[model samples]
Target: MGKTTVIHHAPLVGYPDDKLYTVRVIDGVIDGIEEEVEGKYINGYDKASVEEIDLAGKEWLSPSMIDWHVHTKLAALHSNRLNLSNCQSASEVFESVKQALNDPKYDTSLERNLVGINMRNSNWTDEDLFSLEKMNELSIERPIFLLYNGYHSMWCNSLALEVGGYGSSLNHKGHLVEQEAFDMFPKLTTANNQVVDNWILQESKKAAAMGVTEIVDLEMEHNIVQWQRRYAAGNDYLRIHVGMYTPHIQDAIDLGLTSGDDVPHTDGLIKIGPYKIVTDGSLGSQTAFCHDAYPGTKDNHGIYYYPPESLSEMIETGLKHNFKFAVHAIGDYANHLTLQTISKASSKPRIGSTIEHAQLLDIEKDLPIFKDLGLIASIQPSHLVDDRDLCHKFWPGREHRAYAFKSIVDAGIPIKLGSDAPIAPMNPWEAMAVCITRAGQGDEKNPFIEAEILDLETAWKASTSNGKTRLEVGDRADLCILQSDPLKLDAAGLRAMKVNGTMLGGRWTHKTF
Candidate 1:
């Protein structure tokens, strides 16, 4: 591939003390950065051997965003089977599934077909997974599998259930099951290991268009192979950090994979992230483990998913293998327990000990503990707007710390943002809008959580290229040249921000749409 060169002229953000400066690029790294310069082209390589292109002063050159948690192909993987997140009523979900049977959008007869669908709590029932009548109704002339909002749950139609050997199994309510069902879920889904790999590469390009230079891919046990294959394919458009789910921690350790182990691209491109564990369910389902019961509930603290002692043992096992923990703690109690577990499991402070969704926090106390404990809140701000209704209803008296971004920042914990795509869309700008507006446009009935509101810079910092820190001298030249400066744009304007061009590793990966 030929190296494309460019001279950029936008004021750079994220310099020490949040200063702006000018930068020049050679191949894929920042060759020079200066403040108050009288114009200098510092070309190091033989000028005769390099090709150059000028920016024409139309683009705001900035490092791309880095979404720490997102599911790519898997985000839309089951659209053909069922979709829970899209429908407000059970009939809507059924109609959506019914439409997939005859929708010309997909060539349903193709072998190795993958369909993405969404389902909601209202649409699911105990026997839905084994419903032959429903499968017949939504038949797309091929195997079909439906994925739920949490991404952990899967509901297979009769054809999929039969092929995956789960047609007769009955152990759990709705579509959720234990290891057996979880294992079967992936097989029944449209995106097989290989298909998923291809889709992620395509999705990664979309992310690159959004100026996402880096991503922390938290792969499920079955996705490790897909990750390896995609990385080996040599499309280094985005620097990726791979993570192993907790169920695969032992296998990863056996295979000599630990936190920070490099596999492809640069040393940090494909490293293992925290050992991921889901401590509780989500707020939408009213299953987030909380200290206080949900509003309508009389006497339940939700489910703990994993017992404290078991979680501790798991932490100890992970620690022995030099793995950092990425606990998915959505509720206040779940968050508190995960924090306590970390305190007891490890003596010395460990970096990258992230609490996913730290959504419902006790900010005044929890924020400081996270700061002192060195924990990162791997948050998905979009969840706030999507789940606002349930949040208000379920979180009666404890609405204070819900989605408390500003307080969390003030308390001193580094905040990393993500799309959590299958639950929300994979648009950082959408999240940015939520982070700032805290309201879902024109929804007067829904108000922004007062304490959670963040300033533009903080919101920008949490989602932009600086969000992941990739603007050093020798960093990958993955960046987006925007028509408008995000820093200068309003919250709603952030979503409409034009993509002038995208450069991944110094190559023009995508041009303006």
Candidate 2:
């Protein structure tokens, strides 16, 4: 028989308050759960072979969380990049880069490029927007690449553009959007395997510390080989689902790889996730393919990365290859067109497909269609914290329908929460806080679209594995031990809740006990 491990006096979140719970596990699966009367005298497990942990009612236990949408590779790359999120204008960004160049840590040699990330130009005035001439003024010898906060645009200097094979005349402003930026991303951020692996390892440990047991890494590159290499190097803190893009679909099909197929040599730690396709741009980039133009523009309905027919063809092909689809749709028109494409595909996806970031929806129309289509909504609530002002500025008069979490739940659509890491922090607690309060971090007084705020229970469920609210028998032993009861906490308390330990398959990935 497998060794029995018993956890005693656990305060299970969302469970009965008057009773203490004892859970037993065998072979990394929950075997049984027993309720004990509060204050009852109980003896510890005395069996010679039994492993025991007595929480003594000092910790709250619940299912570990899952980040359904994240760009793991990009997150790792951004870990060391110069942060430009705090820069308010193009001049500030250039000044910050100039200062970083003087710092000994940043490399400015001709062979290497200086990279900065999280630049937001959505709220910047036209005069403050980045220009190629200004970028070239910094240095002609050193290449500079600045990634926007939304990951949909990049601002590069003349040398960087030359390195990326783009002529200066092609984009005088040095700004690349959508496919243009995506194509040049890896070229500028390429690093040795060992370096990237170390970065990913550090980021994985950070996720484990935050009680994240699983993540769907939707990095905009073919990730299987990279993940396999990482797993071989003992970087296995979290179970990862590696999502692929449309460009790699033919290769995946030719290799007979399907969605949910486990990569060899990883012991099920990594699996092929979905066939991801970006149908539109992002709100912060002012290119989300909205139904209406920006408040000041006429006949400008944003950009569509893929037309409806092209998207339909890709979905049909993916369905034939047994791949689940994850369509990136932010604006209402993008979501509407994605739904239409999926519904009209030649074949239906056998497994459940997901809409990545169904951010702005014609809620009254798309909610029912989304539910009827049996598609899951993979959302990153922390995006609202960042995009709140952008939504107000670019998408005025449609605030009520943006990031409508409560409405999605009420319509019976399965909603999963993530951080879209590197764009936002990969913290489930922060996501939950934002979802429950409809406010940004540390600023609950100014709630945006309060009518769409989710209840605490709904937000908690969205953050957990398979939306499980409580630990139960027959469940996997992926658990998170918390310093306090999340059920009794407000938004501030939830964001500040400390994690005592994290477990995966009965093994402690992180522990303070």
Query: What lDDT does the true structure give each of the candidates?
Result: 0.67, 0.85
> Which candidate should be chosen as best, given lDDT against the real structure?
2
TM-score for each candidate, following the candidate numbering: 0.85, 0.95
lDDT score for candidate 2 against the true structure: 0.85
Q: Residue 259 in model 1: shift from native, Å?
A: 2.0
Q: What is the lDDT of residue 480 in candidate 2?
A: 91
How many steric overlaps are in each model, in order?
17, 0
Model 2 alpha-carbon miss at residue 413, Å? 1.2
